[model samples]
Target: MSHPHPELSSPPPLGKGALRVVALGGLGEIGRNMTVFEYGGRLLIVDCGVLFPEEEQPGVDLILPDFDHIRDRLDDIEAIVLTHGHEDHIGGVPFLLRERPDIPLVGSKLTLALITAKLGEHRIKPETVLVEEGQRQDFGPFDLEFFSVNHSIPDALAVGIRTPGGSVLHTGDFKMDQLPLDGRLTDLAGFSRFGDEGVDLLLSDSTNAEQPGFVVSERDLNEDIEKVFRTADKRIVVACFASHVHRVQQVIDAASQHGRKIAFVGRSMVRNMNIARDLGYLSIPGDTIIDVKQLDKMRPNEAVLICTGSQGEPMSALSRMASRDHQIRIEEGDTILLASSLIPGNENSVNRVINGLTRWGANIVHKGNALVHVSGHASAGELLYILNMVRPRNFMPVHGEWRHMRAHAELAKKTGVSDDRIVIAEDGVVVDVYKNRAKIVGAVQAGYVYVDGSSVGDVTDAALKDRRILGEEGFISVVLAVDSNTGKILGEPEIHTRGAGLKPDAFDDVIDKLQDALDKAASDGVNDPHQLRQLVRRNAGRWVNETYRRRPMIIPVLVEV
Candidate 1:
């Protein structure tokens, strides 16, 4: 397996008739999936998405793929081909479209609809092309074909791209669920056809490569969901992904079977389900769906609520309810069903939400306790099967962490692919494919572009560090008045501390030390206000760190008179 090295320099210009591929995101992590394909000086993008913020990314709303790689080349782009409607697959469309609103979007009907609705909120009316399974379209030098792939959401697809240099098949997040709720199966025959035609490179989803055996079919969860409905005594609150149309269908069926009225919660949940319903992807029984306001009129046992926040996002509806911040209160007998698998790095937040709901006397049912959730990615067995089916000359694992990609590379090798043909790379790593060979030539800047509230790409690592310090170690501010001419302290410094485990009076000893340090700096001929502020900061920071063993954010305000 080829690994990216820090010493790797910017790749030389693309060789004649060569295809250059660079993953801006979704290489080492589970989300923010964006891949740029360059052929004949034009670009083809696949899956512009976003990554949900983890706990360490304080105050971050979303993490976007750094567009610096393509910001200058946006005009060379043909279109963005979406694979599915999941947030991790299409959530970044609006942001990317903001860069160039005229860029076309290509996807299945349902996928296009979901993104279109989302873009509507951003007031972006994008140009979209709807293509179904087995359809082929040419965008510049890339001839693309779509194939049906069953996932937790309906209308998922895998794409095949044909260029003069080579042909590539990208299996966007999919599983070989023989019995999908929508009756759509992964196109093994299509993969075999590509294998027959000689696939030069294969970029496959590696999210479940570490897990053994095929993923459980979506149909297998019917009995488990039915059991939850059969036993629950009060309102059933099901939390899942807003874009999970099939899972929502299952929840709707279960609620209908139990004669309970269902209401969608969360803005995203309501909007996506409405789109799925209107597009005929999600099936709803007659009079089964009710307004959220009507939820109050129904009996406790006669209502079902489907909301977002299965991942325990702080602002999600379920999270708000768990924290007693939402209008819908959790009763003693309510059944809170977390109907989704936990994304990695979300275990702590999910557990906190679970504990909060449990404290409210609500019965909690999650994947840990029940068979209510299954992954949508293909596992080891299915990956091996696809590897054998495609028989590509080169294999690159995408959409997973290092361990998962490494495990997938082993699977590719097991299928007789040469070790030299397997390239395991992280985000920003650039690979060039020519004459049936793929090599990691270099890398680009593919760092996280944080979204905090209305700000995009403005939150730097330094700002996040300061936020973390303020949250963890607390903050301290020192106010002092000094004479400009003599650089002499005119008054005693006033100190204040928050979350530093010290009262304002506790900083008295440090104030004098700070004044003395300022006097020394002034005597040393450092009369600059900025220099004096640094002196006070250093003195107070040293004193606090030494005395309280804490390094809080020290703000020194030096006023010149």
Candidate 2:
């Protein structure tokens, strides 16, 4: 309400005075993410992401990184290179453009497809220079190459960056999936080529670095999904991230094999389906995808509902269906398959949606109950595999919480990487690189920006506190009385309440009690709105608590009579 604080919460930018890569966010926590590698008067940002706070942040919408430290150096930001399509990796682009609108954005085809789709929602046309596997581009003196890597999403990759001082490889969120659902694998041979080409710095994802073994391949999930469809008795409802087109393709195959017609729901699901099908990345059988309005025409056993909201995004189609708001109401004996795992901070929302669906008599299947989800992050073995392939002089772990970063650094040490090469960073800590060597020079002013409704750079900590107070304490109203010629209030006060009062007629009665009190407070020969307003508020607050057994926020309005 008070013009939300400018999102750049920190003071200023401070670097290591050389080639420093600063973490704006996403080092310790999961979002408001960015990594800046600065050298030769040019800046290259790997990602800018947003991380949603836990359930405790009531009514506080999405939170983004404060770009203040880097905003002043916007001219040095040559490009923002991306690694994948996940929300945590790309969701903050619109927010980033809000601060520095001119940075050149680059990503693979599918990554750009998803981002452009998101930008379309705001009527904002994005300008992204598409990069593909085996292609390299230069940003001033920084050279970049996209090395394809397999993940839950299609076209995931690790970036190979060549700066003047040396070459740095940023292994974006990835895993080794030789037999991928999308038929692409991390090009270890390509990484080997980078090492052969003299790699100097390495940044890898730490998400699953603590997991002991290798990540499961998506190919392994196909058989399990096939069994679910072949065994399901009634309608099949598939819940997943809309951007996971490869998974969607697999589900479509399962549904088609079972002779079911797939009807996609959720904004993201529909949009991505449109993009993937048009781009030839997904293949659905003829007449397989039908209009939701025609759902009744299909037989119950042949109905497949592919919906979004796997994580209980309130507006997603599956969440609405849980509330019985969707056109295709879930019925008894329907098989609801949650094809995505619960993200760290979204367990509550996801479980709530599952509970709501179960209450409607649908049997829900998730992890442990079925083969539904597999993480795209690398496990210990896979992490080792990547480190061995890219053999760099320095290493940094990214893409996880504080624990993940620590675990990953430990893993690197265990895999023959020395402690000095592993640089553990947090949000705003800049690492300076020069002549193929790197070290943490100092810190940068990096923090988060909050986006609520149409307000960007709003919802600072102060705004969040205000929202929390409004949510918890509600609001109070006070009435004051003044003599016709003087400002004064009565001894007793009136109580007006919304959240604290149980009485239905409380506010109506409050007006009368307030007028009575005001008449008493009136000055003999003076009447003033400001003075009366203050008196009304103070008395109303005290009176409400005493008479109604509760207190609410006090707002006083005074009118001269």
Candidate 3:
């Protein structure tokens, strides 16, 4: 029961000044959780994270917070402090290290280890310092104290910073699970201690602010999952978040309890679990772990498989398994367990995968059907409890959508925090705190940076818009060749269409109209290559829309021979 006892070792001479806070991301969103804190001339960043791309972000691999403001003030940054190792909280480490590799990164041991592995992919070896709960360290202009917090991942932390203006507490993603699988509870006592010290401003995770009542404990899943393993006559495959070490540990324990050997699927699950086991965060007996390739040798009832892709990501091991494209095929009577929550906006994909599994005659079990998963965020009751415990003069809710933040703000008012004391923020909004007084000041560039196949921020909204158009309406390309010496038409306009849902015969009328328009335009002295290209595009686009009621992308090419 090592709780957070963040006591400053050496205190610098204090200067009562304004503390600036910036929500670079995570406000009004679910991912990309980054926040900037500045006092005097030095700055300290709490988290550098990323978000998974949604359906609208086609061809994008990851979405990151816009670091334009930080890029301009890199010299002022003192350190990067991390709360946990979940992707949304630590996914952007490599991207940030690529820009400023010299900045020191501090976090719990497992948190730093996870990011270190990520930085290795980019050939970056950053300066990393491992700090745990009860440890207090000083970074220029800031005194940081770390405390243990219960999350789905092991060794998650919350931070308290002593600034010139006052003490600021940041509760990174957490839940008050009295019976956590790891036996480490959310340090409510530590928060109360900080409250007694007169916290100036508090920034708490609002991810589950709208969720009512208490969340189910991680320990509660053990019995139900073990029952599945005990009664299953065939193989059992479980899908969960790759970073959920606690859940993975429970799955392993269940397998061992049922006399079943375990196999790890999905690249991320294998890698992250290995890291956890090597770091002593996970305990797996060598005899119980088997390779996926060896599954054929084991009896169906003697094995358990754990994989990623609980969200139904197409490339994940579970999704591929559902499609019968993976090494292990789903057989009749097999039990497929999804030990994760369905992320918002991912219902269709998850349902599709589940339907595919069901069609194969495998029994599908998920949180929707049973008590398999619990959120790692504080629900409304827990949020109110924290608000009452850590009675900070100012409050800012982070790490959720606008609705969640607003709900949490209203809850704060219920706990006696004044309306002026709670600042509702979106991405890029800056709030300044001076002597326990907080107010909205200004803003900075806090937009999305789309990552597409080795390119960062190269994809624009306009490009995505065109992609959506092409996906919906397809595209049409027209080529016209004219004599170079004389301004005369050369031949019939060559037209090509793809994915437009129209056959050549169906496009004949449009093509005839385009040819006639081209002849008329050339006769009207519109023979300039640029003008000819524009004329073809305009006429072709107009005819397609007026006739077919579809506006596909039209590409016009004018070749002067």
How many clashing pairs per prediction, in order? 0, 25, 0
Q: Which portions of model 2 show Cα errors greater than 4 Å?
A: 1-17, 98-102, 196-198, 435-437, 481-487, 490-492, 501-561
| TM-score head-to-head 1 vs 3, winner | 1
**Model 1: per-residue Cα lDDT over 202-315, one tens digit each:** 999999999999899888999999999999989999999998888899999999899999999999999988888898988898899999899778899999999999998988
Query: Which segments of model 1 are wrong by more than 4 Å?
Result: 1-5
Q: Answer with 1 or 2, whichever has the higher TM-score.
A: 1
lDDT of 2 by residue, 1-87 (tens): 111224324323433334667777788776665788777777888887788766556665787776776778888888888888788
Angstrom error at residue 155, model 2: 0.8
Q: Whole-model lDDT for model 3 versus the true structure?
A: 0.87
Question: Per-residue lDDT for 289-376 in model 3, tens only?
Answer: 9989999999999989999889999899989988999888999999999998877889999999999898888998888788888998
Residue 160 in model 2: lDDT: 86
Give the C-alpha lDDT of model 1. Answer: 0.91
Q: How much is 33 displaced in model 2, in angstroms?
A: 2.9
TM per model? Answer: 0.98, 0.87, 0.95
